[model samples]
Target: MYTPPAFRDDDKDSLIATIRAARLANLVTATADGPLATPLPLFLDETEGEHGVIHGHLAKANPQWRVPAIGDGLAIFMGPDAYVTPAWYATKQETGKVVPTWNYAAVHAYGPVEFFEDADRLLEVVTRLTNLHEGARAAPWAVSDAPPDFIQSQLRGIVGLRMPVVRLEGKRKMSQNRNAADRAGVASGLAASERPSDREVAALIS
Candidate 1:
């Protein structure tokens, strides 16, 4: 994340909020073989460490968990993102110096990666993860809802991941570098876009 001072999000709460809202994240690690990455749906336990702990799982067949990571693993979480055209900038009309850019929010968490396959801990992790996502629905489901033997068998196919965050970095590029007029124009243009994600970026800018 090459974040300029104007676009840096240093606030802890803001960083955690962006991470929580992100539905999917990329987990990356460096190894002797090469760099390995996996897209995962991770959740944070804010109460765990000075920063926080991240929890998720990967398929047992995924080789990422087998390789030893050099150091801390990184989890990349992305929030609403939209492309900004120079046409949306007021400066483009006056000086024709404006260039296109992107507006988005993202968080990167770094921590030592721990992998486990213990049935009890795996079941607990699966249960919490299930509740976190399913809680939004009217008929929320739970891991325990399935037959015991079936759930146990399912858990065997995946490996649990636990990363206690050692550091966190966040970036929010929401036209903060632009002048007020240009920012307002961007907000207006994004708000009027057909993409729902664009509207979300607009709201963040406003």
Candidate 2:
């Protein structure tokens, strides 16, 4: 999150886009015992608040939901990332001063943490999350597709999570700090890489 001025991303749309594209996130909270974290598939409700609201669930047995968080929780969303070699920098040849760095996009959302167990609300959250992820498939699955009793039993084993976002921070490091020639070199080098993520970084730079 230590973003330099050149790499800071203040655009709201860009921040939300990165968050939406991130299918998984790390939810972190501070507790009396210690810090607790969980990786989950979270969804954003853009209509809920001035910023937005985040919704997700954790296993009923996960201790993270049991502990009381002192204040706000942090949800971390990561986008495409790639390693950048100094060889891709024109400055490396000019002054041999360039070092390796990384190019990536990430967003951090902070909000008050709320845990709930209402069966009806849990069912609604599960249904919406399922539909959001499954909608892109040819044969999308639905919660109602399974036996009612079985689905109900499964829901009993989880707890719902809600966080109304109070702050959003985004960082996009895509060679923006480099000069035009160095940036062009980086783009060319990344575009030629076999790694899909590198090609994605190249596109962002372009």
Candidate 3:
């Protein structure tokens, strides 16, 4: 991810938190044809492995699952991000030597990838994913909510994915490189923004 020392985040908990905060992520794998990527809703099992195991599923027709992975796959998780204007830097007024940049948080996990079609395992993955996304809803839905025959038919159309994380890399660029005055300006400016992501980044800065 080319993270500089100042921007690198090595804290395991912080890295996992960023992954959880990202509602969606991209899974990338190298292949003989080229690099293939898929946008997916992946869940992490923090209790497993030194890092954790990632779980998700793909459409049965997805070519990504059919392609043989050359090496470890990379799953990218992105958190809150915001644009930082040069105007948000005190140095812009003091020396006019500032430029625009971005502030954001992200995590990259690498691991061997596995694709499967076992109905029992697929059912478990589907149920867990559904529950995770619906956990906070007043009227939560479940795989069991549907007819067993219907659910079984639906499961036939998809495949499951598992990746036991071998390593994790995280970066949090929240104006920590800036002077105190500039950092304050960035936080305040973002806080005033109407964009929810900007405001989220503002909270991280503070």
lDDT of 2 at 39: 98
TM-score of 2: 0.97
TM-score of each: 0.98, 0.97, 0.98
Model 3 lowest lDDT segment of ten: 43-52
lDDT of 1 by residue, 1-206 (tens): 78889888999999999999999999999999989999999999999989989999999999999999998999999999999999988898899998889999999999999999999999988899899999999999988789999999999999999999998999999999899999999999999999999999999995
Query: Candidate 3 residues 1-206, lDDT tens each?
Result: 99999999999889989998888999999999999999999999988888889999999999999999999999999999999999988889999999999999999999999999999999999999999999999999989999999999999999999999999999999999999999999999999999999999999994
Which is the better candidate, 2 or 3, if ranked by TM-score?
Answer: 3
- Decide which is better by TM-score, 1 or 2: 1
List ranges where model 3 is wrong by over 4 Å.
none
Clashes of each: 0, 0, 0
How would you order the candidates by TM-score, starting with the best?
Answer: 3, 1, 2
